[model samples]
Target: MGSSHQTVIVTFNQPGASFGQDAVAALEDRLVGAIEAAQAGEFDGNLIDCGEVRLFAFGPDASDLFAAMEPHLRAFPARPAHATLRIGNTEQRVEL
Candidate 1:
């Protein structure tokens, strides 16, 4: 992990009939793929879905993880909502 931790916060809109299970699974795949593709450092992170928002962290830090998550940034707003990834202490408003 890097000196500064990175965190990806996935804010989900109203979940579909699947009850977010599908979304969660897909997110996992996306995170793995992005990490491999980007060659990001190893870290510990998980998927956190808060009804209105779903957060995905790559590990204990957010730098490498943030770099790894670019591939999966487009998988959102199937209907109309928002998803954000906060790498550092400051919250950056990423376009969905």
Candidate 2:
């Protein structure tokens, strides 16, 4: 079987029914520093319009990617947030 790449996906639920594109764009910009600081992952953009925003990041190490993005995800003014950390063939869900 092919090996799975390590990945971290942080999701923030919108307080309202949906999110504004401008806000999502701004949020993406806000995480640039964190991603760069990790020095191990790349922000693979986000998926929106589902009453939540999910940030996609992939790296050689899932832990490094999660560590870098955790704080930013926590500081965001959104409730019911969580992250899906995929390590190889396994996946773990972490509440932010």
Candidate 3:
């Protein structure tokens, strides 16, 4: 959290990932970039916390937040190139 914000949690929803060094690294990089971009200059003291990134494509994890966020996530500059992001009008299908 910074000046006006409270907290920032980074999430990389790997529906059912085949955990591996390369896979983890890719997710890490993508998540970190998303967090950085979300800052939007509003907060400089962003804190990292541990949590799970529920897959936002379908099923129970999806919500208003996911619905609204997919589009924005697609716009993120460092989005994982090996992930299938059904974000907004852009459908970026990447494989790891």
Query: What is the lDDT of every predicted structure here?
Result: 0.56, 0.79, 0.34
Error of 3 at 93 (Å): 24
Model 2 spans with C-alpha error above 4 angstroms: 1-4
Per-candidate TM equals: 0.57, 0.83, 0.27
Clash list (residue pairs), candidate 2: none
Native-to-model Cα distance after best TM-score fit, residue 15 in candidate 1, in Å: 5.5
Report the Cα RMSD per candidate.
Answer: 3.9, 2.4, 11.4
- Using TM-score, rank the candidates from best to worst: 2, 1, 3
| Candidates 1 and 2 compared by lDDT, better number | 2
Please tell me which predicted candidate would have the highest lDDT against the true structure: 2
Clashes of each: 12, 0, 0
Candidate 3 error regions (>4 Å) = 1-17, 40-96
lDDT of 1 by residue, 46-93 (tens): 444444445556555455566567546565434343435455556665
lDDT of 3 by residue, 29-79 (tens): 554454445432221222222322323222212222233334445553332
Error (Å) of candidate 2 at residue 66 is: 0.9
